[model samples]
Target: MTGAAERMRDRQMTDGMALNPAGPDLAEAMPPGVLREIEPRHLEEPRGRYHGHAGLLAAPHNVEEVAAVVRACAAARIGIVPLGGGTGLVGGQIMQDGPLPLLLSLERMHAVRDVYPQENVMIAEAGVTLQSARDAAKDSDRLFPLSLASQGSAQIGGVLSTNAGGVNALRYGTARALCLGIEAVLPDGSIMHDLKRLRKDNTGYDLRDLLIGAEGSLGIITAASLRLVPPPAANGVALIVVPDPAAALDLLSLAGRQLGDCVTAFELISGQGPRFQMEKMPDLRQPFDSAPDWMVLIEIGLPRGLEPDTALEALFEAAAEAGLALDGLIAQSGQQAADFWRLREEIPEANRLIGAISSHDISLPLSEVPGFIEDAGAMLADMGNMRINCFGHLGDGNLHYNVFPAKGRDRAEYDDIRKRIQASVHEMVVARGGSFSAEHGVGRLKVADLERWGDPARLQAMRAIKAALDPLGIMNPGAVLA
Candidate 1:
């Protein structure tokens, strides 16, 4: 098909389409190797808490094939559920048994299309993993700061779609903030190429922003232009032992005032968390004693000309004088800094391996964090039997409120009580003028919660947009919205 003809056809598909749109013949769409090559390794899968909703699906290698497949599915009225890495904790990626959906993965679109170093932007296909983008940036003496534990396999599209916020959110911002523009395939197979490197543009509507955290409910992101930053010249890392969360908050304000924007990371690690990790991971050693109750993993990164060490030293000294920090250790080398960060990043994984957990990713007002911790901790304990590993971007007041039950308890049994626990936590969070979800987007896991607690007018507007863009509701139906 000619480019213009293809584009015209795409536009036509968007019109007069039923909620259950008719699709092309699926038999001819499949290439020979696409399904026939599924041998032993392809079929062999690990036995885990597998979501029975959606079954396994193949990844598309290129945009043309992916778009074609989606178009055909849309025509057939099959729900198109976009997948990437399949590492989503929420039930978003699960293929449910009813109204069977076609899972379209961008894993094969793993290509670095272009890197515009001069413009401080890079264009990568949807399937390009986060680690690959970071490597590309490093090669050009720039930095792509959107990072997380799943970066090794988490594709750019999924990250941006979910609007993932990782460790560096304090400075560089989240996936949404890092993105310049996106190129996505609409539900009708139309390519909305808004990929531009301009720093500022007030065109009609910023359509790219709609798709950023849409969780693939609107369209399938094909490629994106991501903003980059200059590599930090110096990194100062210090793990401070604080008396409690209140003191950690105090130290955060102190460091923020003293260090200004250079305070890149202010991570709160429960004293019990590190103790758990030390016990779990034999190779990882504990840096401090077990009596502090709460510890702060603070980081300060400066530009090339600034003296990071001197600035950090001053902050620590002031913190000590105020009795906010009990003791501290500064990482003098890169290896030591990595160790400090590992302690913070691996907490969730470490806790997961430990046993049962009813996790909550919530955010509250910065001033209310300390109180929320103290009060919520007691409340959770009062509810029944659970231990809370409360930590996260303390600077931003986001807390990963994970509830781990007593050891050896069956987590499946707690599933029935999941709603009650979530309601308790969410009620407390909302009372503090906080959000139910902080970093993670409202995937299938939180859809009902979103409907209940979400602002009605806001939901109406979102539904209007969804109806306009994907009237068929074939793109990730029952996700983010009911």
Candidate 2:
């Protein structure tokens, strides 16, 4: 389709559907407190990537209220953009160039509806923060294993919508596997009340899975029945120095064999990340006196009988004997473990402060990760003198490979080659049997990448599904499918 035609179609989908927050249409349709003017926080995404345009903001308190607002929007054929915690990195919460959409924020629906401790399940509303869900699980002596750096602000609805994968994904899996069922409002204003806390349900066409990672293009999730698990009685963390990515991978294999499933997290970090952290966020203490060229942060959670510290020590000894690790430090206390994690979690903030010219969240097969890293570095080195910070949940083969300016240089000077850098990295990733987009969903930022890298048949099927479910294209227009 031509660019003009696509723009016209997008605008026409919501033609004559202008929403005025003070107008009678929404004022009369929604309850008094549910409708309000768009606030500054609602207009901005976490990364400062995209500025959203919204004519109205709705904070529905219940599923019925959410359905009512959706019903009104469907009748008017106005687009709906769902907002949650406003912490997404890929601009999923922001609608930049579409007709002013109705921003649906589920902040008022923050509640832990029911907790079935016996079944290890909890039903939580969409607005419940990830940290809040974790706390609720702790109250029942269980664990909500979907942990993220933005857990304090990111809502459960947005987490599931993006199928977020975090550090614990190596052990418990992503958000999709943690969810039992979801309650959502379809594009046509119909509520899909399938929030059952069952282990298995073979009903036709698993709509629950469909909406989980749809990024609100298909529907707005109101609540979910989340799977919970037993909390490990003991946990340990260690930071180990490795010669390079290849050695790090070897260390991972040895540790996995020694610790088995108890290995919860295996993160790969570059010297640049620690240097940036020291420069930008000095409050968080660095584990090493000076940043090693490469390091891996390993975490393991174990039952009471299998002491975590002992297990971690055994793994470290084996890794060192195998020439995989040069040096290591095992956490002796809970505070020490938290300190190690702080260093890993704060790297993104440091990256933000340094200002990346281009950031790539890509994944490769476990065996191919080492070669890809080496080849990608060579590729970027040939392009420019840009510094690279490669780090992420190495256990799952996902890396947050980010590019920045050299020391004492500004990113604005490299703006002309940002797209080239991104394209080069993504191309290398694809050529090496890797995904261009991994845990982070393809929000507005990577839609073009999706089109370029996605399979032709898969893209066609996705477009067909979007058309069938939201014929009017009133749900997150100009997102994911272009």
Candidate 3:
């Protein structure tokens, strides 16, 4: 299994067979109390797109146990699929059609190791939920701006592993940018203790960044030193109706001109979003009397002396004068701000309830966004009778462009054309120099997409690194690579 020939053959069989079966040998090698019974949740992903098989479930209590479990799995040649919150949409946590991997769950490692307020850093275990991390930061009067709707369940390890980009990405950046260091176990079960709290280190080869978004292919991130920001003195939210995607983009430019870094988040919402919410989630209140064709949700954070509402009103007036804004609402209170955000955050869940024939998390150049949306919508309409819910962090060019069946039709009926729809969308995205997989890492779902659209030299280097680190190809088989 260590030879080059064996490695090449193993890559071919990553989704086909296990190199070696480790039913009893792996069991005997596990640390006591580390081998728990596999649960249904560990094998299921958020979108119900992938279901995996687990020969063993190892819930390591700490990094030492985590290393030991990895070492044992390496010895047995058993593929190891690291499990965190299991909230990933792209099936990174699941290993369908591969070897019955050892499911490595870090839920037991949930602990905020330390918080150094002076350094503006928090050292937290991989299993700690994002909500818990945020709560800890708040206790010290700081802010953890890396947010997601799944924050209540998405663990820190998976967040960094995926290098997630939430709404605040316009201001705070992605998970990779926010992380200072990490404590991880390499594929060979050796630990890399690079979890330093310092902001700058010019060390050789930055493996911390390598593992951050590797999607558990290179190694397991057991813990991290995450960067935290100071809470803004004043904050405001506004929902401004734009005539179209073009106007929304223009409004974004205007907001940038006026607010600069104070503009924390700028989200684009299609009218389909509010309609879907009304149809599926009847109890959740709508922000507008009627669903506008398009709108932009803006949030600004200012220094102590500035008034957020005043700033927003002035910005809206400028936008109206420029003919970029039709109507808008500035949050008068904190509850109203939360409600505005709720309208933006709940779109994904509503889309899920309605079921999607095809979903894309794609990103493009800022200027290309409006054009891509309009062209994509026209193309999709010609393809089939489908509804589009195109929305996401517009400030960052990441769009959760999802397609659903038309009214009174089930998504199951569109199965035949689903593959074509995804391929067409990705083709357009790549032709325009956009990425098929944006914030979400390339899990089992997008491996083919990666192979098709991935840059040749970059993909070669990635494969070389994978082979060098994981010679046996046992870490998350059939993921990230072929």
Candidate 4:
């Protein structure tokens, strides 16, 4: 079945049709103000990894308009790569080496269709940015907890499509858990309007889940009914110096025992990230005079009367007594809290400036994380004198373990060993029963890794499902699957 599906997709690709920028096919089919000239930004993705091939850009103002564009692409046998905010780290939003696809941008469709404060739900168009959704939820006295560094630019549809996991995932869960139902345009341009606010609906096959993290291989999500929660009465942030990753794990256990689910985010940071920031972006405020060997950014949101500062202080004291934490500073004001978060958020930008030889977003079982880190570091050290920046949501077992060159050296110097380093790190992760790709979906960049490490039975099932849903393979072709 999979072989036949692949042949069918290949046959469709051979159908003589070219995506012309000024062609009448798109101009005649799209609604006024929807079709626009493709810009350089539309063809580029974050990380400067992939430069997509998009001849024309279309910003649909409504779901019907999106359907019309999809229908036109289907009829023309052209590929459709859905674009949203252009902030995805993965190459999912970009078609780097394929036929010039119809870049379907959802920017114009940004809208909060409805907000039900009582039901703790908000129906938002896919074009709505994550920050916009969070702001709207706050205005309605609710919380949309899918928080990420790229929240300002990442749209809801893209977030749902990748099933993004951020710091708050330790408490609130990822995009999949936050979404109730979604309205989408299928590969055949048919509308799947299943946007319900219900908490429980065991009706039939979960098409919503299927489309959420499929990277648009199955369909293009138009809008979603997002799950919201009551805003925490009191929240505080603290930066604590930890001895090492093992100590960080110990502190995490202590915090969970003390605060339980009130612990919103527990991030592990290495001295390398801070040092890089200080070198590249000294203008940003640093929480400490010097970068410590390791630190943990702990955030807690407590109910009314359970003072967050007091709870954090107690946790700190307990952690210190347990030898898990050395020293810590808790934010006294909102500005201070924001300052602490700013430092954490700016590390990625700093990494970009330094230029990494190889970067990995991996997750390990809670118990295996410390061991994997130690073993991986030793393995890399054996290969070369490389600097490693290991950091991420420790509470969730996800780490952005990146490798770079030694002092005064460029990453290009280590070009020969980039693939070896990535493979070594990923092999350690998988051997320890972890995942090579955690929060980031298997976009075009990681399709090879997925094929290499993905379970055979699971991969087979995914291909079959893709064939069943997107037989022509027009929806984000060559994304999750090769």
Candidate 5:
């Protein structure tokens, strides 16, 4: 009897054959050399979870294998959809309505190339898991701080491509800031080796910055050199309930002003978000007995020889005295801190289980967060009985504006309002001098919206760069620039 992988592969081929009855299937159309390079079973078989536009195509092991596939697709004028952990919420990894693209997966190219603790750099292959890299750094007594909800599955390539922002961004910065250099395979199969680990090299154009947030539209990243830091001696975590988003902002200001660089994390949570966790996670309990409209998760790290408790206590006292903090829950131990963070990190999963909702990941000037919250929340509440979960990197003013349907409403009915909700929220974002797309890159999901609202000159320049680098348009087509 065939194993599960074989069965999945066979099922995919059967589906592909059924979908393309008149033409040759994906496996049948593969070039001769490329076909031999890929295992026959892997081509017509599914190796992992397949979703979005481009489904299961082929899995590549190294840079050469990936380049070979891209070269073959380029010669044949076929689109190439690059897949990693497939954890993108904006449909970034999905294939779209266009040329039946060849899916180039980097799942097999995982390797830790080099670790330089002295130089503060770690070179990892594209397929290396975020947690794996972090662990490697930890083993060396260093710190690799790029993190997210799906770090277990999301690869370095996808994270860099999307420029992911996580909890620690308030201290260390986003993925773009953490990445020093990259080794990528261009659309036409040429290798662009700019993986230099140095801090300053102002030679010419910053190619690394371009590829970091390109969303696979320009090239496929194979390896990367990331910046690492020294681990903190101790951590201080607090779960504070605030009266509103405004108070959270004031508390954030206090943390920034008083603690300076020690303020490592400043995240916001809504009552609905935590309530969902309490209902779904079962073991999760509200840290405070009474629920507030908004909550703040603050984390600070102490230097060697310094105590965290004293500093944290003093900060909390200041916040309470200033009337910015209502009530708070300080984690008594590291495990308790982990438990508190798990609740914040699992919000997306909780929302996913609930069903389709209009989600917006937008950013604004940090000071404007409170106004945006009031206006957007009031406007959305007036629409109907929809449930809104407004929370995220409050220190950065990036809110994940998610709206759920009224109780007992069918998913299909709620999904129909997605476009309307997006337009309204995006308009609010633009009105407040904010960005429509923040950490999450403009994948196929937001192409039309980007086209409509994106600055004309910037769009033209991006198109020109795309045409300059990928004239054949073989790189992950129908993404970002589209």
Candidate 6:
């Protein structure tokens, strides 16, 4: 079907509530092993904030099988919600109120297709866990630098689909930068086999880039050719206590001046995070006897000849001399380094236990971060009595700005202003030239935010592209766009 006729048919389909795979036809058309019953895990999101609806489940073993499933759904006029690792925070994998859709799970397609150590490339299936992809790269003596706390469960497809940014993004960039190419099943049931290992392919249009961060709205990504780097000869991690947020920025600048790209990851951590951990997780080991107002977790990787310990120690000394650092603890062993990272990684879990009134994943220009933190804290103070935990990828300008109710009070007490708090914070972030959704994609959670703050021209172009690509409106309906 061509343009006008296709759009008209789409309109007709939308005039009434869309139907999911109902009678025997959808099941008969699907491959033998593709169909399965929906599970409780599939319907519930991580945060329990969104409960999705799916009439059927389909797990494709290969790209062709994926295309077949897409064809079946298209023929049946069924919306498709592609489920990744389910580690997404923004409710992108969820479809709550739309027509009963087909849940497309890529878990069965897990495979490390190819690895070229000489060329620093690894072809990985979308269903492969991020840790598995990293292991494959390690087996080939190359480093796939995309690192996230949820690596054990987060799949490559969702990571790329969300264009995820993690601790190492300051050095390695996002999932999009680590990827060279992708193979996806377009909305019309045809496969885009563009997973090339080339570094420079001047194709007319970059469909790979479009699909990477589209949150599966564009298509279902089947696999990717990922970029890899040579492993560093030495690595070290340190927790440097800064008196305040501005000092943390100064410390970052000093590290750049002294160590340059050797700094692999730099995370800002608020004392509130450790306080939460101590209150909720008593068994958690802490690096300091008392948590300072703010600290930065810095990891450095260096080539041969330079000792990581000496480099970190020298950097700390310089920072202390410059009045940017108060106290520090450098990891003496691999286990100690893991413990340091464990503390940072478990902050989110601690927050979950305490229960936040509202949480924001935001980013500001490096210069504005400290001021924003101060201003936003004061603004929240005016809005209500609460505690604020501000932490995240300090090197990359992203912060996990979260709000918690006052001590001994339940989060439900602030339910009246929950949405107001979120909006107020996002407004401040937007006014400061910062993004309210930093690494998290605009899933169902932030549809209104995108509409309110999104540039008109960009929204128009996005809608036009969505209409052009998936006129049937089956690919991840109501995600990234309303």
Cα lDDT for residue 378, candidate 3: 99
For model 4, residues 1-482, the per-residue Cα lDDT tens digits are 23322433464557533332325665677777888878889988878988877767889889998998888888776788888888887788888664567888999999999999999999999999999999999999999998999999999999999999998999999999999999999989999999999999999999999999998889999999999999899999999999999999999988888888999999999999999999999898998899999999999998888898888889889888888888899999999999999889988999999999999999999899889989999999999999999999999999999998998999999989999999989988999999998998888777778888999999999988987887777888778887
| Clashing residue pairs for model 3 | none
Worst 10 residues of 3 by lDDT: 1-10
Number of clashes recorded per candidate:
9, 0, 0, 0, 5, 0
Candidate 2 lDDT, tens digit per residue, 168-233? 998999999999999999998899999998887897899999999899999999999999999999
lDDT by residue (tens digit), candidate 1, 1-482: 32322332353366554333222345356443332222232222121333533332546676666677777766676677787766666656653434445667687788898888888899999988999999998888889998787889788998999888988898889898999998888889887878898889998899899899999999999899999988889889998888888899899889878888888888988876776686677677667656357888888879889877788778888998999988888888899889888888778767877664577889999899988988888887777777677889887788888887665565666777777888988988989999998888787667767877899999999988988988776888767886
Which portions of model 3 show Cα errors greater than 4 Å?
1-18
Q: Looking at candidate 5, what is the lDDT of residue 199?
A: 99
What residue runs in model 6 are displaced by over 4 Å at the alpha carbon? 1-24
Winner of 3 and 5 under TM-score: 3
| Model 2 TM-score (2 dp) | 0.96
lDDT of predicted model 3: 0.90
Candidate 4: Cα lDDT at 57: 84
TM-score pick, better of 4 and 5:
4
Q: Looking at candidate 2, what is the lDDT of residue 130?
A: 100
lDDT of each: 0.77, 0.88, 0.90, 0.89, 0.78, 0.90
In angstroms, the error of model 5 at 340 is 0.9
TM-score, candidate number 1:
0.90
Candidate 5 runs further than 4 Å off:
1-56
Model 1 local distance difference test score: 0.77
On residues 1-482, what C-alpha lDDT tens digit does candidate 3 reach at each position? 21322443465577453456547779989999988888788888887887777888889999999999888888778888889999999888987664467889999999999999989999999999999999999999999899898999999999999999999999999999999999999989999998899887997899999998999999999999999999999999999999998898899989899998999999999999999999999989898888999999999999999999999999999999999999999999999999999999899889989999999999999999988998999999999899999999999999999999999999999999999999999999999989998898888788888878899999999999998999888888777887
